[model samples]
Target chain A: MKMTKIVRTTADVFYPFCLVFGLYVVIHGHLTPGGGFQGGAVMATGAALLIVAHAYEDITGRIRKTAMKILEAIGLLTFLFAGLSGILFHRPFMANWMAQTGKLFGNTVAHGPNPGDLNTAGLLPLLNVGVGIEVLGGLTVILLYMLSGIKEEKKP
Target chain B: MTPFLLLQALILLGLIVTGALIIAFKDLLAAAIAFAAFSLLLSIEFYILQAPDVAIAEAGIGAGLTTAIFLIAIRGTKRFEEKE
Candidate 1:
């Protein structure tokens, strides 16, 4: 069954703002108070809003399980690749190899209580992105599975 | 009492009320919505406690996602708790 008009409108109006905020939290993990897990869950909330507003059948086509699986795989693989890259470069696994290296995300942070710099986190941002994608995919996949399973339970 | 502390106390009270409502309501949908409200209050409490990361996570997973999941489950099963 479809939701009331107000619910649909609320979902539409809130989704874009939630998406942007989630991405901001993910990207600014090192510079801000939120990290990959938190931001990813935030983004997942937007997906949930839409799912709740629409019937399972109307949404299953768009929020495909296969696509979420692929996204989850890519996110985890990217995180592992990052960690192993440290080993390949003769550093310990998951080491901050790029910190203060004058490269991407390599700016030196001040010693104490300074405002955060987005460009100074050194591989953390990448890791955050990876985790964010993974969490979002994982949560959505779970939701899709539940919705799909319950579809059959509906009384004829 | 300081204004901030007063505000915090009110929020805490709201949280308690909502938490009770979650259990007290026989309608599963109302309970789910109450749970969402409880989560939202908890998120605010986290924020007040200087844990914005936790606050955002709670707001998202607890308030938003969990409520939706509960509603979906309710749709699958039944909206009202059956009298035993």
Candidate 2:
């Protein structure tokens, strides 16, 4: 049976906040406890919440499998690009080329614990974003597949 | 005992109860919900163990996503467990 209106409403309300928080975790991954995998899972959790609250046929319109595949591909490509960018810069295969460059996310860090800077951490933030998107797409795809495989029931 | 330890013990107890509930529920939906509860407790345990990253992942995947999948599957099949 379809979930009650209250459950659907609650899921709708919480979904945006979940997405935002997941993005925050991904963006601040370099300085925070969570990284790409964790943040992506969190984001996928939001999508799963919506799916659980609605019927399968209703959700297909909201979440397209093609779009999810594209998203997954993009994320993987971004990760590869980030890793290979080091070679493009004439550095090692996976060197920290952006570190200590005093550029975007390139500030150097001193020894020991100190006030963390978002502008530091070099390629880590970018890699985190890549992995985060990848994970979100992967997990959401699994949920969608499972949901779609089931026989659809009439809406209440 | 320290309050922190006491709280930890309570969480542990809750975990045991939820775990048992997951297996004992005749309704598959209820079992899935109990599994979600178990996942939540496991996440808390991970956090207490100083693995916040794992905790978040566990909460998201285990409690949230896994439960949703299970519910969807149950909706497709049957709510009650099939007796042999």
**Cα lDDT tens digits for candidate 2, B4-80:** 79878989999999989998999998999899889999999889988988898898789777887788788788999
Docking class of 1: medium
Runs of candidate 2 exceeding 4 Å displacement: A1-9, A89-92, A152-156
Best by TM-score: 1
How far does residue A23 in candidate 2 sit from its true spot (Å)? Answer: 1.0
Tens-digit lDDT string for candidate 2 (A7-72): 999999999988999999999898888989889988988888788788767887988888988998
Model 1 gets an lDDT of 0.87
Error of 1 at B61 (Å): 0.9
TM-score of each: 0.88, 0.86
Q: Which stretches of candidate 1 lie above 4 Å from their native place?
A: A4-14
lDDT of 1 by residue, A40-138 (tens): 888887777778777667777787889999999998988998888899789999988988787899998768898788888788999999999999899
